[model samples]
Target: MNKTNSTKKTSKVGIVGGGVAGSTIALRLAEIGVEVVLFEEGASLVNGPPICHLHAGGNLYREISDQQCVDLLKQSIDTLRVFPHTANIRPTVIAVPKRDKGEPDALLSRLELLRNTYHSLIESDANNKVLGEPSDYFKLYDQDTLIELASRDFPSTPSSLDDWMIPVAKNLNLDEFKYPLVLVQEYGLSVFRIAATASLALSQMSHCKVLTTAKVNHLEQCESTSQWNVHYQQFDSTLGDWVTGYEHVDYLINACGYKTGTLDNLAKLPRERMVEFKAAYVTHWEHSQGTWPEVIFHGERGTPNGMAQLTPYPDGYFQLHGMTEDITLFPKGLVSSTAANAQPELSAPFIKKLTQHWQQDEVDLRSARAINHMAQFIPEFSSATIGGKPLFGAQQIPGTDPSLRAVDISFDGINYARTEIVKASSALSAADAVVDKLQKLQLITNDQHTSLELSFPITRSLTLEQVENFAEQLAEQRHYPSALARRVAF
Candidate 1:
């Protein structure tokens, strides 16, 4: 139960949907002294999966391409330290499975070519003096280094059928892999990390209220007062049941992900086009097993929306994502030209397609396909049981209860953003953009009374590698934050 800030009680903003966008906005607004009330329809910030690459929970990569904030990803990654609920940075390995025709993937080929180029750059003293290590953020390992690193860091059962990719695939349980893995030093976007951190921040931030299990139903603006009346419902304890209530908010931000259309969506903002897809989360599959990087089986270009991705949590368990989005085929996944109108079997096929290479007979062939694909990387998956059945779905963002009355806050005073609702990273990026827009609109203002900003700047030429090495030295000597990063696995 958070109380509004008495000191900064002048401006109160209401945000609907406590997903990535809403949570980030709430934190930013609270920092700037705007009273925030974040309403989330879901009980938790990182809702249960059936997750996707639009899986927003973790990465704070600065090269978000859109330049929403050149440093937002860096700032977002920093939250792993500022907040207690998240995991620190870990070296992410991207293994591209071998392609057909006895050749490496064109993308991987280019990546290897780039690595050679970077090696040349590092070796060139003139270039180092000129470019200053543009490859500082990554640790691009060659075939032998990747194999040795994987074998040392994540030791699992070596595969039997290893030839060319043998060096990189030596210790990894995956029978499928590419040589010279791409090791990203600061790559990862974890949903659980964002959920825990954001929820904790919302709980602790002054003048902020995070209302879970609350659904917005109606929105009406008071033209005279310039405030919006927000009507929402929630299960109230004192009332002994569900109750409807209203709050008068100075600014209303619709950060609702997929449910934006249920209300009168904001004009001029990009519209998020969501499609139904199927995916799975397996907990028991690598129960108390070895660590693995975020493994993505590369699909055709720009087809992650319909591809397979395996992501690991801080706990070492993994979520395997696949999509059954072939709309022309009936029952969804079975896109056979002849069986177009076949019976819809649901998630079994999506999971199967995800785990196609590995073989499992326990669940029907339709379902086992997905599980088997996962078993290649996670051998325990072959023996492990499913935690929960996979389901066909779309964005995991809070959905409007069809039974409840609907609201359209984007009428007059309220504002909304309609960018594609992918993962939590995009949400935070979107929030930054929204905050920028609000700053221009005079809806957001910095606090005059807040504590003075940190003005210290260090004068040093220590490279990023040096700083990281120093951190590692400190981590070894004083092992505290290391638990959040290195010792995270049980």
Candidate 2:
């Protein structure tokens, strides 16, 4: 366990939910000499949808505005600085399919802009050079170069940019894509590793108490002391019933992802928000060359020709996401809150898929569709089979705009802040906003504490082997293949 700081504790904070946002906030607060009580309904933390891509430059989504892309780039760098072990350090391949109306050259301006932004970040702080040299932020490959690389065999280990592109050059059907295919520095993030890291870190924090299998039942503001009384029911298997308890906290932070409205309704705060249900399939392919860069065949989203993504994992396991309505998206998958209720109501089928086991037939059918979708680009992937159950969940977008990727903390009262993060990378920004709010309210004092400035006590102390073992155990506990926890090194 990480030792408590010599600084005196100031105030108590109550946080609901144990997703990335909650976990990040709890650790930051506890590390800065604040008492935190984190409540998680699930047995573990960060057990939501599978997060594979870092979106270092938001290159995958061309529809979002340039500002959102830059914001994502900054947040992604901060995330890597905090959880360096969770990164799968490989570039991503993006190609425009022949059938798609988009052109490859149109992306050049944005790539150049991203490269400049990265250079500026590095100039400010040399440590910000996490994604590698700004000069190598992205590289373009002509058809002739790809053809030449295709003739060479896959190397045992990849050392250069060309080395990483070998599998893509050999496997991808060049005729189907436009020339000048681009390779960006965007990498992959292992959700299992993040869960393990958060669990270990929270356990060691001296002022942080993580209560798993505990659900918040009620919240009441104390008129006398101005503290909030948090009532919760923790399941006790021995008694076969839920045991009720309460905690008093000077401030409250709602970090629930999709269920943020539950706490909002309890506080009688009205807000406009939308929730989206999405999933990505996992497949195993016996590829002679084990490692491959994340491949993207960009097409319009929700249409028949939607984007198809193939994310590589260890042990020949790959995760796939087809953005078509029939694949990762479903009918009525995206819903918004009605004026009567702040909580958006997902269909019963989606709720069942989220809370219970997915039907095996549906999984097989969807997995097959994803396979066929990728096989169109890489024929060898046609033989891949389902590796595990789908990684599915409902994510909350702060506003009604589904295209909005950037979000932060919103204050409801003097002591209450609600975080609505669209992507996992935005968690740190949300936490920083809460920290700033705490200081403004005089709930905590310490102007010098920053995520970048202060060292992460738990993650810094853990070894790679310990993280791998714990991540594998988390994967098994969550009914996923253990290979998902292993790092992909080539």
Candidate 3:
């Protein structure tokens, strides 16, 4: 493949989805002079006024480290700085520690130790530059010190999570300093809408064709030429019908999240090689007053089980989400309506469990709202069997009550599965790299605060090269994935 000709040869890059991931990549590629074409299956709707929505879990930019803080300030100033018209507000997080009786004193002592250790580490040569000159901004305080400050103002009992958070807060000097999270202001109107609209604008600006309501159906691969023909269905507004057609492209980028069915057919990958899981996002209350929290709390109670995060936006609305867990909540197959709605009562219990664990006051349940209530399934491959036995079958195992569905594929057959799986797994490896980089920065702790461990079974069909490359990329990048320029051959 000639690099220069690859850039010139009608270089029509077909993007499957028009979400954030797709838009970001498209914009970057366009800036670099890549001929791009984007296809979206849904109609473009004007996204509502820019409401402050929280970023995904494990997003490292949320912290107040010197570099992150500076980066955030710069980003806000350059991109999200304008207020009133644009909404931008930063709220402070108040961490309360909850420990068993008589454990507060010990926990407080430990917190002091951790605080000092953190301070030392921050002051050390490697981190000193990132932490900046330690002034009152990055002060350290023992439990008594913080409690005294809190007693003078907002007094509250401490929880274990709180104990962990207080040191972090004090170390970062959350109090006294007027950090970015302190001010509540709107920088722009319809920023989210602007973001989505920007995608369309970018496509036009880049001279890339965007076809909405067009669903990709298949891919025709020529063995001789090693090229691909992408088939898609486009709805004809005039005819009030659908028309099918085909387009040629050198590579297929799957930006479709969780919807691997189309890619599965196009790539002709095996079914057992990929797994899918469901995740639910429920908004319990809307912020009517007060600013959002600066330090969003995302922590577990002891084990890696219950995960909850609280994101307070400038809109005075706080979004709290339950952690992702693998429970037999829904039936086996693509989670159906019956399975999702079967446990309406579970919502309250879920809220109660998180609130109790966090020791926060009962939020207004009446204010509860839910979206994407659908179950999320994640695909995994099984690589090996016990005693060198070949495992290639689907089994229905009956547990105490509900029966679970399990599929085992031989290690030899994964490449034959959907190429999307390979791409997705590789993408995950890249994401893991980012995670690892942040972890080294002490911004995130994996397998502790976040779930980075492979919980899904590996299919035996994945090649050693695929698995090793993915693992190597993941380990090298932590949890962050690599860029297209670095990972793919042009």
Per-model clash counts, in order, read 16, 0, 71
Candidate 2 colliding pairs:
none
Please name the candidate that would achieve the greatest TM-score relative to the true structure.
2
At residue 10, what lDDT does model 3 achieve?
49
Q: Global lDDT of each model?
A: 0.44, 0.87, 0.32
- What TM-score, computed on C-alpha atoms, does each candidate reach? 0.61, 0.97, 0.45
Q: Candidate 3 at residue 190, lDDT?
A: 24
Candidate 1, residues 1-490: lDDT per residue as tens digits? 1213312356678888776667767776675556788888866664422322321112222112322222333333333323323333334445555541222333343334433443564475232222123353334445665454445433453221122123234445444555545544333444444554555556666668888888888878776776778889987767778888878787677766544544333222333233233345443454544444455544332232233455554344445554322211124432111122211223555444433422444323424555565555545556644543332233422222211111111223234334334444344445556556666656664333321121001111223333333333432342212222222222
> Model 2, 166-247: lDDT tens per residue?
9999988888888789999998988998888888888888789999899998999977777899999999889999999999
Cα RMSD (Å) per model? 11.5, 1.8, 18.4
Q: Rank the candidates by lDDT, best first.
A: 2, 1, 3
Task: Return the TM-score for candidate 2, rounded to 2 decimals.
Answer: 0.97
**Model 2 alpha-carbon miss at residue 340, Å:** 1.5
TM-score of 3: 0.45
The list of candidate 2 runs beyond 4 A from truth reads 1-10, 288-290, 447-453
